[model samples]
Target: MSTLNLLRCAPHALKKQPVWVAPSRNIALSSFLRDAPAATASTKVLPGHEYYPGKEEYGTVIGNREIVGHGEIPYYSDSFMVPCPAIRFKEVDEELGKLREKEKGDWKLLTLEEKKTLYRASFNSTLEEVRAPSGDWKRCLGDNAILIGIMFFGLSVIGLSDPEFEPITVTNEWVDAQTEYLIKRRVQPVDGISSWYDYENNKFKPTWSIFTTKETSQSVKTLSERGV
Candidate 1:
């Protein structure tokens, strides 16, 4: 039979003890919990599913490629990404069982309530219900706006109390010192400043580093002292 038909009819047979042909403990547990149920009066758990108290109710059972449910919570979501839920939201009780039998006939013949009843038995919510706005984003945006206001207020207080910031490295003295250091180290001499030097003028006439005679003499003296 098709998986859908099995899903529709399997619950009626779920009360019966499953044929325990599974090889491993893991398989046995999922299959037993999914396939069979405990006696209601005694609250008896099936053999393999009862690892501890109420462990059988953890999730649905799986056996013979069919899942049966017990004491599972109902849930429904309208999502485009996830197409299938692991199990039905509602279990098939006697009323739903009878309706399911009738569901085998022409769906068009079924009354609106009957059709709705059948659908509700399997799911807790519809696409329209899930898609409806809950006004949650308003609260979220309000909270974020309050946080932004607080951040701005704190930043204003800090800026008013704190001393003004200065970037010392951007001053003329610092730049001149850095330029002299670079000249002393003969930075990029082959492909740079020296490559376009006015040797006859005994001066650095390159466009970028217009070094005066005094600064150039100090850099050259530093380079000679450093043996480079």
Candidate 2:
């Protein structure tokens, strides 16, 4: 017979039997303690003081002093205090002096290209090597293969179907284009601000000016004087 027919034949077997009840015992003290009302906020007792219910307007007292709500007492101690080192400032100054001397020595060793690279790195230059890729494609493939193998093994153990994994493919031309784009972005001058070279300061200061008619006329006059 089918599962449904078997269940219908034993319908009384599925019905719940009557539960047994124990005899009740007298618990006058327990009932009184359980049903007793808790102390309200106004009638609450503070440490070292007892609150008098119904006389809450006057408040509690202890040893001639009227006890108000718990008062905060500021505490201070030097139990775990640490003593300052005698040569703290002197040691710090000596270390800073040594660092400055070392920096001066290192600055002399760095080439112009290395200095420029350092400056570019301080900015948004993500590439460690501008001309070539930093990581090996073989290593990346190996890592991906291991990850996929683990995933497939886990799915198989759990009785799941294996998913198709596609490999990432890139052309030499695409990589070169990306490298060129990065180089261009790294060396590109700030927009809306030209003539940044400050002859007086011997440094470039990125600045911009509004092209008003008055300023334009003044610039033209200056350019005419310079014979530009």
Give the best candidate by lDDT.
1
Worst 10-residue lDDT window, candidate 1: 62-71
On residues 1-228, what C-alpha lDDT tens digit does candidate 1 reach at each position? 655445343433443564333223355656666644432333444533342323445335321121333323323333433223334556667777788778767767889898778666655555455568879999999999999999999988888887584468855456556655665566767765454344555445445344435655555444434443
Residue 101, candidate 1: Cα error in Å is: 6.7
TM-score for each candidate, following the candidate numbering: 0.36, 0.16
Candidate 1 segments exceeding 4 Å error: 1-77, 91-111, 129-139, 163-228
Q: What does the lDDT come to for candidate 2?
A: 0.35
**By how many angstroms RMSD does model 2 differ from the true structure?**
37.5
* lDDT for each residue of candidate 2 in 92-127, tens digit (9 for 90 to 100): 245444443443454667567644443332222222
Candidate 2, run of 10 with poorest lDDT: 82-91
The true-versus-predicted C-alpha distance at residue 51 of model 2, in Å, is 69
